[model samples]
Target: MVISTHKMVDCTSPVDAARLFNAFCIDNHNFMPKALPDFIKSVDVLHGESGTVGSIKQINYPEGRPYKYAKNRVDEIDVDKFYCKFTAEGDVILGNIEYAVYESTFEPLESGTHYTMVVHYHTKGDYVVKEDQVAVSKEHMKNMFDIASEYLVTNPQLYALKQ
Candidate 1:
């Protein structure tokens, strides 16, 4: 079975939201480790090119985490739409989910932007996923987005373009 979860956040600038996502996709290695050192040790580009579609990321965690590291692939990216999709691979299972896809889209608002994030969960066969189980996974993903959003909102220079 498949399950999808979505959440949105309102921001003051579409550039901040879109660039925050671009940072998440590309500079996560630089920022995530700094922002979430307690949980993430480092994010290394294992294959392909950094920030490009089809690139693979190896996310490492500090000792004693459930999984030592998780691998994910960049599945889709639309600069025009300010959208991105990431597919979780080996050792990256969230709750009972066997496959997870995270898609983020930045929708422009009159004042700023509406950031919508969706996570599609594919379960391991033969059984059903309970409501609580899905909620747990969804909350986990939402918290992640919140953390990123807060970072961008608080530190606009992180996503600022270089001259």
Candidate 2:
């Protein structure tokens, strides 16, 4: 079975939006872990070097959390388009599904920017994925994006300079 979810968020500026999206693509170590310390314990580059395709980033959660770690591989990335795709390979991600793919895109808007996330869940044979499970996962996903958005908002000067 296959399940899909789509979410969209508005940001302050096009460059900031693209940078925020790129931050997740490359800043799990310095930005995400630092900005959202409560949820993410740390992000270690387990396999390949980060900031490039094929790199694997492992994220650790706090103790007593639902899952311990999630290992995601950078499946595809487009710098020009400000989009990225990751394949989640961990117990939490593949628990009720065969595998999961997370895709994020940052696009320019007239006044600000638009960020969209699409999650595709592939379930095991003869198995069904509950909505509640997907909801929780979606919330988890939202928290990450919210934190990154907050970071970009609070540090406007920094992102503005990058633009």
Candidate 3:
């Protein structure tokens, strides 16, 4: 299923948008309270380069109480337009997922900036044929976007330049 979420940030630059995403990814105490042990080993382009396309991030997941070791790959980075596409192929809730793209566009609004995050994904494996389950997936996506927007807006220090 494809889920498109629209939101506006009270800012005038893409740097602020990227800062929010980066802060959310790295700042565990605030953003990732549910997954405390989760640590990001490295976040860089896949092929030893940096740019918009082919940007990849390697996340390391050690064995936990009920969680198993896993790795996620995030590619298709677009710094100029402020977007990136991610595809995970491993022991994830949804297997064989493809085209899991997340694109964020920031435009200068009259008083602030408009930010939109679009996510396109589809389920795989045995659950793929269960067409009726699409609602559940869409709901999850909606919840994710809501949480993200809330975080970005509520935490002004993220893009405030000064701590």
- Whole-model lDDT per candidate: 0.71, 0.72, 0.43
lDDT score of residue 31 within candidate 1:
84
lDDT of 1 by residue, 1-163 (tens): 6564534332334445556666677677788887777778999989998778999989998888777888888899877777889988667575667877788777766655676666666776654555566566566555766676676778877877686
Q: C-alpha displacement of 23 in model 2, angstroms?
A: 1.3
Model 3 segments more than 4 A misplaced = 1-70, 93-131, 161-163
Off by over 4 Å in 1: 1-15, 94-96
Best by TM-score: 2
lDDT of 2 by residue, 1-163 (tens): 7565544332344345556765677666677777788888898997887857899988898887878988889888887787888888786665557778888787867655677787777776756666665676677767777776777777766435342
Off-target runs (Cα >4 Å) in candidate 2 are 1-15, 130-132, 157-163
TM-score of each: 0.79, 0.83, 0.48
Worst 10 residues of 2 by lDDT: 6-15
Evaluation by TM-score, superior candidate among 2 and 3: 2
What lDDT does candidate 1 reach at residue 148?
62
Per-residue alpha-carbon lDDT of candidate 3 for residues 1-163, written as tens digits (9 for 90 to 100): 4332322122233335555444433332244333223432223333433332443444444445233323334465555554544554434334445334445455444544455545445544432323354455555444554555455566665546554
Error of 1 at 45 (Å): 0.3
